[model samples]
Target: MVRKLLPPLASGFLFGMGLTISGMTDPGRVRGFLDIFGDWDPTLAFVMGGAVVVMAIAWRVQARMVKPVFGERFSLPDRTDLDPRLLAGAAVFGVGWGVAGLCPGPAVASLALSPVYAAPFVAAMLVGMLLQKLTMERKVSNP
Candidate 1:
């Protein structure tokens, strides 16, 4: 069990650290990034660009590997459809990000820095996740 969990736990810790180090956990910085008409900050773009480059390399490596180091097989998303549900969800996500200036990742990471401020965002995120799961499950069962 420890072996199975270690990789994910380590990865999450590292990701949180990166978010903190890059100042992504700061709502002000994130809001600044979104304020294109005003004092827009470009740090998030650089961070995202670096992440994209790293992930591109990782994907190339994954293409060469038959299986992950700790898993029997890779569990990658195969969805490519542009359905109404996807569009609605994306619009909702964008609105939430703009309003709160924090997505799920940065919100969760911000818990370590300011639990009081992060609590509401995390709670709302969990509620949204649960609602999505219940909706999907009901659809699958009824269909």
Candidate 2:
């Protein structure tokens, strides 16, 4: 159990540190990025570009690997085609991000740094997640 938890714990800590260092925990910074028509901030774009480059390299590495360094098998998203449900979910996500200036990662990361912003957002996020879970369960059972 300890061995299994260590990898994800370290990864999450590193991710939180990156978010803190990159000003991703700052709502104003995120909102600035979204405000393209107004005074826009392009810092997040650079951050995203860096992430893309890193992930591209990681993908290349993954292609050659038989299994993850710590895991038996790699779990990856298999879906490629966009449909109405995906589109709707994306639209909702974009709108939520724009309005709140904090997605799940940043919201969770900000808890230790900016509780004022993170707390309410995290609470609301938890509620939303609960609602989603219950709704999905209902659909699964009904179907």
Q: Pick the candidate with the highest lDDT.
A: 1
User: What shift in Å separates residue 129 of candidate 1 from its native position after superposition?
Assistant: 1.0
Best by TM-score: 2
Residue-level lDDT of model 2, residues 65-86, one tens digit each, is 9999998899987667577767
Candidate 1, superposed: residue stretches over 4 Å from native: 79-82
What shift in Å separates residue 119 of candidate 1 from its native position after superposition?
0.4
lDDT value, residue 19 of candidate 1 = 95
lDDT of 1 by residue, 87-116 (tens): 999999999988998999899999989999
Per-candidate TM-score against the hidden true structure: 0.92, 0.92
